[model samples]
Target: MEAAVNDQPRRGDTEGFVLQVRKIGNSVGLILPKELVARANLREGDRLHVAELADGSLQLSARDPHFAKGMESAGKAIRRYRNALAELAK
Candidate 1:
């Protein structure tokens, strides 16, 4: 397992598992260990956000407040297109 940081111990790296990268459509995906899923309370078909760190490493996190802002923008777009959608429906 990689060195644990901070005073907290994360569940996924207790013994360090190998993740296999596979090609899915045009992008590659990594299969996370099942223990990680349980620890993070994540389930299949759930969404995860990936962030690119300054050190060239990827950070995986749950939903962020930025997503709420994006949702608000989408709501504004829906309001703006309400007339168009109504016309299309008719």
Candidate 2:
């Protein structure tokens, strides 16, 4: 953990946390600081989504970014091909 600012302890000066992945039994995990966990409102059973970007970096978030876009695309396709899909189903 880097040095904290006045009155508040953040991950670092750049607002980024440099975490190290550690081995836990047979699995590997990273430990988040108490400040971060409380800030994010994350729980033990909560699910986190991981996305690999084009720059070879990984992103972790509470929601899947691609899921929303995929759902939007699916909705458009369904609206555009509703008649054809209905006929094919029949």
Candidate 3:
């Protein structure tokens, strides 16, 4: 999807198309258009990093330090919890 232009103050990113929030299980989510996703260099199941700026505005991106650390930890956690997780499935 092409970017949407407006008077809203923002940084780096050009305003894009709006996505409708819908229910996914008990959580609400917004579906980004495939074109927009491709433009943003995002793919299905890709994680995003979000932060709130000092000016009370929000930012979203793909780079995340915490996520990197968590990913490393996840490898260990997966092995540690494998038996428990497998048992829970039954």
Which candidate has the highest TM-score of all? Answer: 2
Model 3 lDDT per residue over 1-90, tens place: 333443232233555664555666787866666676788899888988888999997777887978788999998998999999899999
For each candidate, what is the lDDT?
0.73, 0.77, 0.73
Best by lDDT: 2
Candidate 1 lDDT over 1-90, as tens digits, reads 232233232344556555555566787876676777798899999989988999998777877759888999999998999999889999
lDDT string for model 2 (12-87, tens) is 6687776666666787877777777788889888888888899999888987678888999999999999999999
Considering lDDT, which of the candidate structures 1 and 2 is the better prediction for this target? Answer: 2
Could you give the candidate ranking by TM-score, starting with the highest? Answer: 2, 3, 1
Model 2, CA-based lDDT: 0.77
Residue 75 in candidate 3 has what lDDT?
88
User: Candidate 3, which segments miss by more than 4 Å at Cα?
Assistant: 1-14, 65-90
In candidate 3, what residue range of length 10 has the lowest lDDT sum? 1-10
Candidate 1: worst-modelled 10 consecutive residues by lDDT: 1-10
Q: How close is candidate 1 to the true structure, as a TM-score?
A: 0.49
What is the C-alpha local distance difference test score of candidate 3? 0.73
